[model samples]
Structures are given as C-alpha cells and as structure tokens.
Target: MPLYAPSPALRGRQLAADVGLLAWLVLWVVVARTVHGAVLALAGPGRAVEDLGASVAGSMSSAAQAAADVPVVGDELAAPFEALGSAGGSVGGAGQAAQDAVGTLATVLAVVLVVLPVGWLLLRWLPWRLGWVRDAGVARRLATADPALLAARALATAPLTRLAALPPGTAEAWRAGDPTATRALAAVELARLGLPADTLGRDERRLGLR
Candidate 1:
C-alpha cells in the first residue's frame, strides 16, 4: 500500500515555519551575545556602577517642593508629585528598551532577507554548473573515433537517459524526502537494459550515474 502524504503546500508551510523558528532563535542568540559583550566592554571587571539614587532623590525633593508651592493644593498632591519623577523614568526606560529591541530585530530581519536569496542563488547555480560540467565530462569520456563504439555507448547510456527523463513523481517517496522508489524504478530500467551487470553491483556503481 502507498503511504499517505501531506500536500506540497503543507510541506512548504512546515519548511517555512522551521526556517523562521531557526532564524528567530539565531537572531535572539546574536542579540543576546552582542548585548552581553557590549555591557562587558562598557563595564569591565572591577568597574563600579554610577550611583543614580542621589540624583533621583534630589529630583523628587524638588518636585515635592514645587507641589508644596502650588496654592490651595492639599497634602494628597505631594504623593503624585513624588511618584511622577519615578514614573517618568520608568516610562523612559521602557521606551528605550523597546526602541533597542526593535532596532536589533530590524537588523536581524534585514540580514536574513538580504542573505537568503544570495544563498539560494549560490545553491542553484553551483549545482547547475556542476551538473553541466559533469555531463560535459561524460560526453568527453564517451567520445570515440569508432562508429560502432559510439553506437554501443549510446545504447548502453539509453537506460540512464530514460531514468533521468522520468517525470518527477507525485508520491511521498519523490516529493520531499524518500527517493528509494524512484531509485528502484531506475534500477529496474537499468536491469531491463541488461547493462554490464557483472561489472556493476550497486545502483550507484553504474557509469555516469553519480
């Protein structure tokens, strides 16, 4: 019985998700490491943190004094005045953190977008060129002055050509991962052609196959 399989779209989606997750994880690691390194550079070993407590306390006192000067205001106004400075500082810190996070994320995303297609292009071109070069080598090897030898070579190579010419299958064994079925089919074809069966044992050992 044939195995059940997911559609190409579903497989593509899964691949996309996996790639995205991997990208995100890599970005996070980079950001974290960068931040840690930056912090270490700024505050080396034996360095002390600058004290902000005195400045904050002074600002709170000033605010409280300003609130006290406001006419007709009760003691309740002092509480909000005291809290205002801390609240503003908290808001500023939160905003800065958000900005930093966004900047880091943008950089990561831009890098991914830029590098992805270049990587794909390299992958595409390298294999295509290699295949062309390989086939050229095969042609060179099959180059013979004798007409009978050429005809024999052609006949022997026909099965491999047929196998290469097979319409890419729709089955699970062909679409995403497993290639055993396609390979088996190719082997059957080679066997049918009665290709130098004694010289070759494995499917890969066949001439011009690798």
Candidate 2:
C-alpha cells in the first residue's frame, strides 16, 4: 500500500511548503556565503596586517644597518646586522602565515557552526511543517479506530488549545477528566476527517481497552 493518500488540497499545500523551503535554503546559503566572504575579506592578506608586518621588519632592518657603521666595530657588527635582516624577513613571513591561518580557520568555523547547523535544522523541521504528510499519517492511523479509542488518542495527542473550537465546555470538561467531553471533542474533529463514530474497533481491540 502507498504510504499516504493525500488530497489535492494537501498536495497543493505540500508544494507551497516545498517551494518555501527551497527559497529559505537558497536565501540562507547565500547569506552565509556572503558573510563568509566578508570574514575572509577582512582577515585575508589585508593591507593593514601585511603593511604592519612589513613596516616593522623594514624599520628594524634599517636601524640595524645604520648601527653597523661605527668605524672600529663596523666589521665586527656586520654579522649581527645581517642576522637582524634575516630576523626581519622571518617576522614578516610569520605574520603573513598567521593571517592566512586565521582566515582559513574563520572559513571552517563559519561552515561548521553556521551553515551546516542551519541546513540540518531546517531540513529536519521543514518537512514536518508540511501538512500533507503529517495529516495523512494522522488520518490513516485514526481511520480504523473506534470512538472511544479515537477520544483516547485525541486526548493524548491533540493539543488542548485545539479544543476551543468545539462546543463551549469541551476544553474545560476534557481538562476536568470527563469522558463524555473527550468523546465529543473527538467526534467533532474526526467528523472533519470524514470518519463516522466507532467505524472500526481495530484501535480499541488492539489497545485492549474495549
């Protein structure tokens, strides 16, 4: 048997739900991509960081070179001055590498923490919001149930707030543990589902309650 037989209205609702879900996914991904790009732009090879490193290194190299010119010690200081230039180059290279690492980490974090989680949560929850699958499943389960079983199931599963649409005292009576009130509430709801009262004893017999 097919898992569900959804009405045309239900199918239409499902289609709209699908379109909305797709739109949301695309919009979310685009926004995430834009934010990711912005983060990379700010962190990657930016002039501020690169220039800071280069400027510091150049200043150090120039100072060291100028200091190496004392007549008596000039030859003796040449090696130290050259070492300073090498250290300056190392510093510049290290700073650039650090910036690159930071940018790469930001990209990874954005995808892991933001993009993946949003996609997962939306995918998991959005389908349930489609009434066709959900209502069809509920309807199928209730189709073979007896009146009392239907009432019992409704009491267990239906939201209490939904009872407000029934006769005035329905919610109050059900909340007060009145079996009659519960059955009446179920009757109204099941009627809307096109089921007649006690149409089958399958559910009650299975539950061993009748």
The local lDDT score (0 to 100) that residue 120 gets in candidate 1 is 59
Question: What is the model-wide C-alpha lDDT for candidate 1?
Answer: 0.46
Q: What is the per-residue lDDT of model 1 for residues 70-140, given as tens digits with 9 covering 90 to 100?
A: 77884566777678666655545555555466556655665665466546555655564454445333433
The parts of candidate 2 lying over 4 Å away from their true place are 1-5, 44-78, 101-105, 112-127, 130-135, 145-148, 151-210
- Please report the candidate that would top TM-score against the real structure: 2
Which ranges of candidate 1 are over 4 A from the true structure? 1-80, 133-210
TM-score of each: 0.32, 0.48
Candidate 2 accuracy as TM-score: 0.48
Q: Superposing every Cα of model 2 onto the true structure, what RMSD results?
A: 8.3
Candidate 2: Cα lDDT at 45 = 56
Worst 10 residues of 2 by lDDT: 1-10
